[model samples]
Target: MKARFTPALFAHAEAVLGQLLRFDHPADAVVSRYFREHRQLGHADRAFVAETVFAVLRRGRSIEARCAGQLSDRRRLLATLALVRGWSQRELAPVLKASEEEWLAAAKAMPEAELPPAVRCDLPEWLYARLEQQFGADETLALARAMNQSAPLDLRVNTLKADRETVLAKLAADDITAAPGALSPLAVRLRDKPALAKHPLFLDGAFEVQDEGSQLLGFLLEPKRGEMVVDFCAGAGGKTLLLGALMRNTGRLYAFDVSDKRLVNLKPRLARSGLSNVHPGRIEHERDQKIKRLAGKADRVLVDAPCSGLGTLRRNPDLKWRQNETSVTELTVKQASILEAAATLVRPGGRLVYATCSLLSAENDAIVGAFLDKHPEFTLLPASAVLARQGIACDGDVLRLLPHKHNTDGFFAAALERKA
Candidate 1:
């Protein structure tokens, strides 16, 4: 049944939350499929379902703690709607019984400061400890608060097709309240989240739905026209298309990945992007002979390596429970291997950019540090200097964009050059 405003909506939210709680699949994917199967649900109803489910995810740990061990997917969902949504006793009277209402009152009345650190922060203890080792308690708490909220919708103007000023004026003319991004010249942050999938500008490929922080990584790579570049882990070619456009479609921009399925999705994006220089190719691994042919020849290489993805908690709150120290430890090893292989393709004096959406030191600095230790031929370049040269102002030898600090999804990027 389609989700309606009555008790069915509550039941529907619990059903979707049940699937997402298992952590078998991504929350967004499950939610998308649920809506697809029941297309009768309107836009407002969908938003209510999605927002409520995501709120439960964002505040799950604290809610569980508040429930005093009396919790189910349903109670957790209801309590989140009550405590976080500030639904009153009378407001919840429709769906909740008197006992449940009394329990909710107790949960809301509990003093949060008395709760354990993990519960108070709504983070796994292991994850909290890992972050606290670097960020300390106060800073980690601040970052957690920022990550717990919803992320802003940011769009990157495809400069090859549309300028920022023109896109901003057009959005204003359309009554979409938007302003230029603080960090990236190509960014336009929407004041409100509005669906643009069917908009004329989107149809014409005027912009790509990219995070403002993500747009900085392309600038860090800064591939020039006619230069050879590679997006080593080009999943769906998000950055690959941007790099091709940056080159003005003049260079051979190779998008390499192990999954042909993801590379296949790049086809439509490439067409919509109107770029002909990008080659979407699948390789067995970084050691594939096809990649060897470009060894020591490409002008720039980007290793947007996979990681624990904890930095994107605002978008994927389930990641906190899905990832652990063991998983992250294993990922660090894989990241090191990928970085080493990607580095081999950077010619003498060519640039190599190692980046991740992870904020962990083990995934970011440790991986880059190990690579620098093993490969003595590469020298670290000040990422800030590179951005400044391109007229993008950001400070840091290693670019660290944080949700609390930058209001952008957490991202880390390092620039290194092969010694001539």
Candidate 2:
């Protein structure tokens, strides 16, 4: 069905609301599957259903609070349209019962300050408390609000084949209205999200979809043309492609991950990337013996360690509900172990860049601190200095890219060099 800004579209959103609330998989994946199964939905219809479902996911706690705590999936979807999208009762009357309209009006009129802090911020209590400690009360709320909003699409121009100006011009000629990214020199920020899957530039390996913060990690790694490099935890090889391009496709870049499923997805991207230096392989874990020979051999190693994915809330809002402190605690242990194992691959005087898409200190700064404490041969390289060499300027000894601060997904990276 080609849905409009009509009640029928809202009905479709309501139908899938419960599936998202169950949190069996990511909301985006669930929504994609729903559209795939229901092939009758038009692009606008899918967009309407997706946007409404995401809005509810972002503010479920607050929406439920407004609905007197017993709201069903249908009511949650309706409340999202009314409160978040600002749809008027008259516009919604096409699908609502007479009594339902009255209830929605009451929900919309509820006082904001009456709700608890966590509810007002639409965050769970544990998450709110943790963020409050680091960001303080005022800034935590500010960060939460930023995360609740939609993420803008960011693409990194393949410098080996095309430059940023050239790509920006092409996008402009196509009426895409893109501009140079403020942070990463390789990045281009689009004014509006468009499907670039079939664009000529994408098909020809001119650029790849990467967050501006993620592009920063490649810069921090700073792989040279002939140096050996490893992208540990290279899920789908997003960063591996950037690293290969930076090496001008002259270096041996190994992309290792635990899942063959993820490694398989990387094959197409590696082919489209127009780079011949990358080797994608599946590993048992960070300690797999396949990496033993590479120890003390690689010129640079990037441990883009697995994390809670909390920094990507703008794109993956359901992660907030799916994760808790227990999961984060377990991840910290794995992250530390992986970092220690990947550090072994760095040759003397070679660089090791550890990064995470997490907002928490335990997964980022603390882990780095513990590693530095245990390993006397490695010394910290200032992230600001490394970024400055690449024509990007950001403050901090470590690269801490927060959504509120950088307008990119939250990321933390520390560059370490093994003493020669």
Candidate 3:
């Protein structure tokens, strides 16, 4: 249910947006901090504040274009309500001053077509240019429109504990509306985004909050029972748990990352997962001695490389504002280095899947193409054939999922097989 708008709720949203506009910290972190400090705010009020602030973040450029004069957080929020949220002038009068009414009316009357293409799509010019070059003008606009909206809550049923049908039934029993995801068989897409932290299904690890696009990566890797698999750069072990369950918890699945804090965060999830074969380890880097010890021994290695995270804009609208060409350039270098190191762990005749939640070609195809040129032993496997073998339908040399096309986060993955 939508929170009933009040003057205090509007004040709270404006305050949060002020901090978020600074963009010093992650948007979620800043909102979380605010919530922690203000324990008095109820769930509905907190939801309203977060949704309002995020709406501004997702359409800040468009909101700015519609407004005249000095644009403060209050004006941005007002414009958002008027233009984006479809708040009628009658609806907004309760919150508006007489001086602001005419200005807001003007903003509401402004044609979005008058703005530049990037502004109309609410994308940074540099990023919009790159996407336009990659996907053309029309496609990029559609993609941007999808990314600017909120993402649906997708859950991956942990096969080790429960099947998709069982979990769906349980959710239905609890009055939560969900349906099987169109892409991943194990995925269940919730109609409404509900807090599931304390849900019985979540606590017992019957399902995990994961994107359907992310679940596809595990099928690409296709780990078998009793095999040795490596999840290189496994942050908080989301995919790692998926890999372990796919292996029936019989194989040794190593979840390696540079951050000890992220590995620590994985502990509770791992426990809830009921998987016995997952080994969480902290590596100094991709070339750590620990990684070198297992060189050429892994049956499968998945490199879910870190990128600019532009593809997750639906949930993390702040990333587009926070990331720039310079940061993305640096990420490409690290991604290349990590992919190279992870490739060494895949045994001859084994598989390696390089994947990312990035929409940029610089971080997706370009990196893989360059890597293939350097490593002759590794041959690119058709992503469609791999997914098809697992009963998932896809059609391409690589798995490229766009939110507009797939109803999932934008993802790119390429499977490679090492010659025996």
Best by TM-score: 3
- Ordered from best to worst TM-score, the candidate numbers read 3, 2, 1
Clashing pairs in 1: none
Off by over 4 Å in 3: none
lDDT digits (tens) for residues 281-308 of candidate 1: 8999888897899999999999999899
For model 2, how does the per-residue alpha-carbon lDDT over 1-420 read when each residue is reduced to its tens digit?
335666667767887887888899988889988898999988778877888899999988998998887788888888888898888887777777887977887898898779888888899999999998888988988898899888999999998779999999999999999999999989999998777999999998899999999999999999999889999999988899999999999979999999999999998888888899998888997889889879899999999998999999999999999999999999999999999999999999999999999999989999999999999999999999998988899798999998988899999999999999
Instruction: For each candidate in the order shown, give its overall lDDT on alpha carbons.
Output: 0.90, 0.90, 0.94
Clashing residue pairs found in predicted model 2:
1-40
Residue 114, candidate 3: C-alpha displacement in angstroms = 1.8
lDDT head-to-head 1 vs 2, winner: 2
In the range 207-266, model 3's lDDT, one tens digit per residue, is 999999999999999999999999998999989999999999997999999999999999
Backbone clashes for every candidate come to 0, 1, 0
lDDT winner between candidates 2 and 3: 3
Off by over 4 Å in 2: 1-3
